[model samples]
Target: MAADRLALALAVTIRHDGNGGVADDLTAPEGLTDWVRELAEPLRDALDAEDFTADTAALDAVRELRAAVRALFARAVRPGPPSSADAHRLLPEDQAMARLNAAAARAPGAPRLEWPDGGAPVVRAARPPGFTDADRLVAALARDAIGFLAGPERERLRACPAPRCVRYFVKDHPRQEWCKPSCGNRARVARHHRRHRTES
Candidate 1:
């Protein structure tokens, strides 16, 4: 994907507006455009050294790919009843499809995952390789994105308490505060304003 696509997509989803011009986390903390780059680097490095950025355009390209992969997985997990037609079966994708199918067939206890709407059967039965393939695909997404965090953050990455901006942040210690004090304070002020309006 194009550099801007990766960078913009991540920026939009992660919405780390604190720094928009330059990307960080994936490479030099100066190369990535979002926190995912930073989070993904360690795990991505484990997959391949060249899987990350070296310059501006390259950084954005992979960053966008990262965001795209997230969207893809989200699509896979959508709650809608499966279509009777097997609208999005993972088979026929490539060698991965064949491997995944065979693995599913071997598992005796696998759930027979089929379309909820009576579409073509997707998961005919529970398969052991289902998760492994998904994990591998996540790795592949990371590889394609050039970097990606290992998935959920180490700690419970919190969202800022501000009503207008729900930004995320890494809690440094047990005594740590909000994502940004100013934002937190602003939110408190807004709450107070609402209270006064009700009082009058």
Candidate 2:
């Protein structure tokens, strides 16, 4: 399945609770490690290479980053221009700018022209030798999220229409209004019930 880039990064922090609700999953270090492993390939490789072990300090740092990213995504999908001021409110102004700057600097580049097959090459960002694996992973994810947010797919990003569902998804077609068919059906059923109650 095609990966949902920004959504995947944001998803590490929260997930559907067994009782049909969302709950925080990044409350501990192991949860953070599990979340890192589930990320897309390039990002996963960076984390794996470092033999990075999650600890409470790293967990806290990542959570702060996640909060900034989530806030950015929420604003991106809104009707108007996303506020830079609002972004700074969720994260330290310098940290927010640094993440965005790092993302811009490392956004994926074109495939190598010297590949034997003359086909799409496996593009990997060149990290300096001194950079730790954990640094690469965090940078990769932040870049992924920024690239996705700034690209045309931003138009397709939508918050799920179901009243109780907090997830976001990309609209697959012009008429697609909900994150999934179940959400669409739930919305329709709710509207039907509302109409019946008003008429009765």
- Considering every candidate listed, which one attains the maximal lDDT? 2
What would the C-alpha RMSD of candidate 1 be, to one decimal place? 16.0
- lDDT of all the models against the reference? 0.39, 0.60
The CA lDDT at 47 in model 2 is: 45
lDDT of candidate 1 over 72-95, digit per residue (tens): 333333452211212244233344
What does candidate 2's lDDT look like per residue over 95-135, in tens digits? 66576556434333333333458576565444456655545
Report lDDT (Cα) of residue 144, candidate 1: 31
TM agreement with the true structure for every prediction: 0.34, 0.71
The per-residue C-alpha lDDT of model 1 at residue 137 equals 24
Give residue 70's lDDT in candidate 2 (0 to 100). 63
Residues forming the 10-long window of minimal summed lDDT in candidate 1: 81-90
Pairing residues by index, what is the TM-score of model 1?
A: 0.34
